[model samples]
Target: MKRHLTHLSKTILQNSSSKTLPLSRCLSTQEAIERRHHLFTLEKKRQVESVGRIEKIEVRYKGVPKDCTLVMNKDISSPYDCARHLSEWHADSNALALIDGAVHWDMHRPLSENCTLEFQSYSSTEPQAVNKAFWRTCSFLLGAVAARAFKEDVTVKLHSFPGPDIRSGSFIYDVELSLPAWSPAPRELITLSAELVRLCRRGAPLERLEVSEELALEMFVDNSHKAKQIPSIARTNGKVTLYRVEKHVDISKGPLVCHAAQVGRAAVAAVHRIIGSAAGEPEQLYRLQGVALPAGVMLNHFAFNILVERAKKLNPARSPFSPFGEDGVRNMAATA
Candidate 1:
């Protein structure tokens, strides 16, 4: 049975490679995504194996149901595991984890040492941090959907997304497409929105991994913009944080939501093109804007439409290519 399963996996991989070969000539977006995902998986597996010995840590979970101390594996167990110890409600609704009441950590990231843990959901009394994480995840998912929405002929290079600004009324991703003078119609926008919804329905867990600068550069080498930003990102922590949703992987300084399903009501509000250059930047950049509410937040259609309308307007986030002062540039690039 083991041999048969291995053979089956190989067969499937070979078939997929053969099917995508024709489009692989130009390094299609799908192929690039597959390559990056494969590299990420290999690197993640290597890192996991390198942890030959695992130690136990005390996790003082302070949240609903009750506050208790749970002993968990150090560098192996995550807050999600602690959530599972509580209840399904926690395992599902928790968006981000607060460590020692200070660091906002990703639910899936392993605990490095003994610390207090608190889960944050969208409905928390102060949901600002959770909201920001949700918005950032939306921006990241928007880039994934946009990268796959177009035909294999179109070259889509994802630039960078600004830091999440919930007050800005939308999440944004700036992409550069090879197509000239192409604008999406209303129907096309709806289709894109549906695709995003489909992705959310899959309920894929957002896996977080911290990788070395070398691995980060290699993973994003296909996209020049991300490759450029990785060095700047690594300069701070000496490591780059990556998040994987199903087969899609991207770079972000993140404590993103636990899963895609946390994004319940979403719409591809608008795609605005930014042309012209004050500096030596690309003349064509497309800003993909979208609005999303948390899974349990039930707003009326009219109210949701208002949000959609507001999101359709241009967001005032910094451009990826704009030359700002050192602090401004660092802030803009840190969020990407």
Candidate 2:
């Protein structure tokens, strides 16, 4: 069974490689999405099998509505698991988890040791971290939508996105498209928005995985744009952060919302073609912009309209590049 599984995995990887190359303008959006979904499933299976053993970890949890110590499986007791011990509300609304009250942990990433845990929701008094995580998650999801939004012929190469920026009134993703010198019409932008809504409507929980830089590169090498960004992303820790939604893995330092259902009334408000950075840089990258309200935030259309209008402008957090070659757009909404 092990050998057969290995052979099956290798076959899928090879098939994915062959089908994805020779970028064309002939593949439909549905076909592209199907391909992406298949590759994601194969990769996720490989990742799960990589974790060979099980162990136990003690979690000393502290936070609102109540506090308790949880005995959980090591590398299996995610913050989300701890939340399940609290309440449905905690499991759903909480956007970020603070371990030892300082280390910002992804809600779905496993806990490895005994430590105090705190869950932060968007409405917390000091919600800076939660907001940032929400915003970064927004940017991350923007990438996911963009990946599936373009027709198969239009190779959507996700380069990198700046960190979350709420003050900018939106999250941003700078993507490299194989199609050159093209601008999105209003109708096209709306279609992308619909795609975002469709994806969010599925309510997939975001899962986090920490992999060595080598594994990270391996996972993303198929996407030229992301492959280009991996080295710079790993320069600081030599490890890569990956977040999953229905098996779609991508790079990000995340404390994303517990589930996609939390995003309500999403709109892909605009796309701006960014040009002329330097050689070896993506000659043209599109900044995809959007605004999202949380599920419980009952905003009147008037207020929501204002947010939509504000999000249409070019977000001024930081340009997507810096001295370290890392994307500079910091979290307008990520945990501090």
Candidate 3:
């Protein structure tokens, strides 16, 4: 699959007259997405190759179907792989992987060392971690849909998303548009929501990768806003973690749900404008908000409508533009 994508990328680049197309061009979105996905595939392959010698580790599994120890390949096997050794139900229902007793890890992320492993589903007794992961994934997918929803004339620059507040009843992504003034009609919002549902229905696995600061900068160089935020994000660990769903990639401090299909029902409830107060702030920011429920979660239409109404209101979550100095930037990057 990686080889096929690499070949396809080369074909795309060779077919184009210009090496790089401007953001305003219609073909730019497709070309940029292909290039980034190709890069991610290559980088991931290289990292896997670097882990030359394979070693075995004991993964003490906990949860249903009885607890047992499974021998997994270190730096090669992920929690999802462990699930595969169990049952299809384990793989399909689990949303996040909990390592030891505390750390929430991505299902696709490799197990570096031996530790107690447990899967957290949306229906877990204590669903806080899974809920947060689901919310964060929703916000990330919102950015993905918004980036491609408009025509070529409209240049969409994604700023950043606030931390997930599940109790607040909505997920969000703050975006900047080239348009001076515009409002989305109800139908338009519905269209965006439908696009999101279509993407999720495809059931793409949310792939996670942690890259060096330099590689991350190269990946997001097209977006000026993300470029500026990268340095602040890399300050803590000198690396940036990225999540990719299909062809779309974005920055986030994530332990996102295993697959897009986990977002059962969702709607693009509203897009509220955020006005900048300071001199260096953006001229205008549009907050794209959405409401979503987990797969198999049955809610009546009236109750769901109430949730949608609550999501339509401006979420009181902290503004991405709020001043936090260096510390604030770090905190924002950590959650965003």
Assess every candidate by TM-score.
0.90, 0.81, 0.90
Q: What 10-residue stretch in candidate 1 is worst by lDDT?
A: 1-10
In candidate 1, position 143 carries an lDDT of: 84
- Please report, in order, the local distance difference test score of every candidate based on alpha carbons: 0.82, 0.70, 0.82
Candidate 2 lDDT over 14-60, as tens digits, reads: 33543464342433433434454555566557766766797777888
**Off by more than 4 A, model 2:** 1-53, 320-336
In model 1, the runs with Cα more than 4 Å from the true position are 1-26, 278-280, 325-330
RMSD of 3: 5.8
- Candidate 3 Cα misplacement greater than 4 A, ranges: 1-27, 323-330
Residue 189 shift from truth in candidate 2, angstroms: 1.8
Residue-by-residue lDDT tens digits, candidate 1, 51-118? 88888999999977789999998888999999999999899989999999989989899888999999
